[model samples]
Target: MIELGKYAGTVLAAYGVSLALLAGLVWQSIVANARARRDLERQEKNG
Candidate 1:
């Protein structure tokens, strides 16, 4: 790990924010893909 010394808090906070945003993006994509797949299947069955 890079030694940030007194700047450690800022560096750690940046890493935390980056991880949270990445996690959110992954969760959103999964939910969206599942919803779209379900809709497509329903359309296929009805049409």
Candidate 2:
């Protein structure tokens, strides 16, 4: 890697936090999609 020198720790921590937040958002979206699909199916079946 290039010489981040004194700022290396801070830079790496920021990257880690950004990646974690992105992963959480993706996971939440997938779960919400599945729940919505199930609800739709149930409603159709009862109609």
Candidate 3:
């Protein structure tokens, strides 16, 4: 159904890069949310 001789490597590389960037963005968003929640809790406790 598909040709893998000429474009397989390029396609795989593109997919790998896209996956890596998506993972990094998810990780960053999680870390930022955690930090914000923690800071809010700390502020509430102090004030």
lDDT of 2 by residue, 1-47 (tens): 88999999999999999999999999999999999999999999999
lDDT string, candidate 3, 1-47, tens digits: 57778999998899899999999999999999999999999999999
lDDT of prediction 2: 0.98
For residue 43, give model 3's deviation from the true position in Å. Answer: 0.7
* True-structure RMSD, every candidate: 0.7, 0.7, 1.6
Q: Let me know the TM-score candidate 2 reaches against the reference structure.
A: 0.92
lDDT of 3 at 20: 100
Q: What is the lDDT of candidate 3?
A: 0.96
Q: Which lDDT tens digits does candidate 1 get at residues 9-44?
A: 999999999999999999999999999999999999
TM-score of each: 0.92, 0.92, 0.88
Ten consecutive residues with minimal summed lDDT in candidate 2? 1-10
lDDT for model 1 comes to 0.99
